[model samples]
Target: MYTLYYIAGIATIISFVSNKEKTIQGLKVGWKKFSKILGTYLKLLIILSFILLISDQFIINYLGGQAPFVGLILGLIIGSITMMPGFIAYPLAGILVSRGVNYMVVAAFITTLMLVGVATYPVEKEFFGIKATIWRNIAGFLISALIALATGILYGEVLI
Candidate 1:
């Protein structure tokens, strides 16, 4: 983050030196765009944080001692719906696994976390259209489920 800030500062300085008028205009445009979406961004952040908190509690309370299939389904749903960065998701999954969560569940969560993006569907639809985005998400979910199943078998968590 600091590195990014440093790079941005340097770039801003260069921009200002190259063309002060353009730099000011660009900054104004950027600020306007950021401000336009600030409310949406805040809402997303608050909703995501609340969902994550509730989901964690729910998982801790009910996911344990449940069947692997149940865990798989729950994981798929959570992973598909939740929008978290990989850095946060991976570490959180690891911590859950260390706390004795089902390996298959973790596998599904990780796979879908990487492949599926339900929360980003609006953006994806903007780029790829509604049909393509839907199909892509469906394919991603199926593939992630398969990968999770394979992981469970390979890890000896599921017998043939």
Candidate 2:
């Protein structure tokens, strides 16, 4: 992350020197766009923090091998509603697996973690509009479920 900041700083310096006017214009535009979405981003953060606070135990118990279908459903909902980035999501999924959570549930969580984003809907809607965002999320959830089921069947049968 620091390296990325360093690289970006260097690039910005180069761009600014090469064309000061263009660089200034670009920065102004970028800042404007960022400011416009700042409120939405903050709201997302607050909501996610609260959800995580309440969900940790509930998710573990529910997905830790209750009913496979229920686990999958819960996984889909959790994955969709949370905005966990890949770096955190993958390691967390691994921990759940090690703790004996169903593989199907983990798979569903991971799939939707990457594909769906109910929590980020505000940002997505800004770019894609409400109808498109809704459809995309729905499609992503269904596809993630299908992938999870296939993964469970293939891995469970083959490895066992």
Candidate 3:
């Protein structure tokens, strides 16, 4: 993480040296956009944490070995609703798998979390229209489901 910060710092310094005014303007724009995103992301993260903490056992009971398909479905639903960058989402997926969640579930979770945008639907709709947003999400959901199914078959004999 510190390495990434160092690299970004170096890049920023280079950019600033090349064009101070442009670099400053870029930083200002980035900060403004990032601040809004950070607030919403943090709020969603908190809500998700509570949901996970409260339902940990429920998750284990349903999504562990007993009812994996149900677990996968739940994963797709939650993942679609979630809005987080890959850096956070991937680590969360690792933690989930470490906790004994099914591989298929985690696959669906990660895939849909990256591809689907239920939490961003309103924003997307504003830019792309409601119909396009809905279709895009549907496509993402279906693709994630297929990926989960493939993961199950390849990794777990889950579909067998």
Candidate closest to the true structure, highest TM-score: 2
Model 2 residue runs over 4 Å out of place are 13-20, 54-57, 156-160
Q: All candidates' TM-scores?
A: 0.77, 0.80, 0.62
**Can you list the residue pairs that collide in candidate 1?**
none
Instruction: Return the TM-score for candidate 3, rounded to 2 decimals.
Output: 0.62
List lDDT for all candidates, in order: 0.82, 0.84, 0.80
Give the Cα error of residue 111 in candidate 2, in Å.
Answer: 1.3
Worst 10 residues of 2 by lDDT: 151-160
Clashes of each: 0, 0, 0
Residue 110 Cα positional deviation in candidate 1, in Å, after optimal superposition? 2.0
Among these predicted structures, which one has the highest lDDT? 2
Q: What digit string (tens of lDDT, one per residue) describes model 2 on residues 1-160?
A: 9999999999999999999999999999999999999988897787777756755556677678767778888888887777766898888888899889888889998899889987788778888999999999999999999988887797672233
All predictions: root-mean-square deviation over Cα?
2.8, 3.2, 5.2
| Model 1: residue 113 alpha-carbon error in angstroms | 2.5
Candidate 1 lDDT, tens digit per residue, 70-130? 9888888888887777888788787778788888888887788778977777567766889
What candidate 3 gets wrong by more than 4 Å, as runs, is 1-66
Look at candidate 3 and tell me the lDDT of residue 118: 75
Kindly list the per-residue Cα lDDT of model 3 for residues 21-72, writing each as its tens digit: 9999999999999886676567656665654453435544545564778888
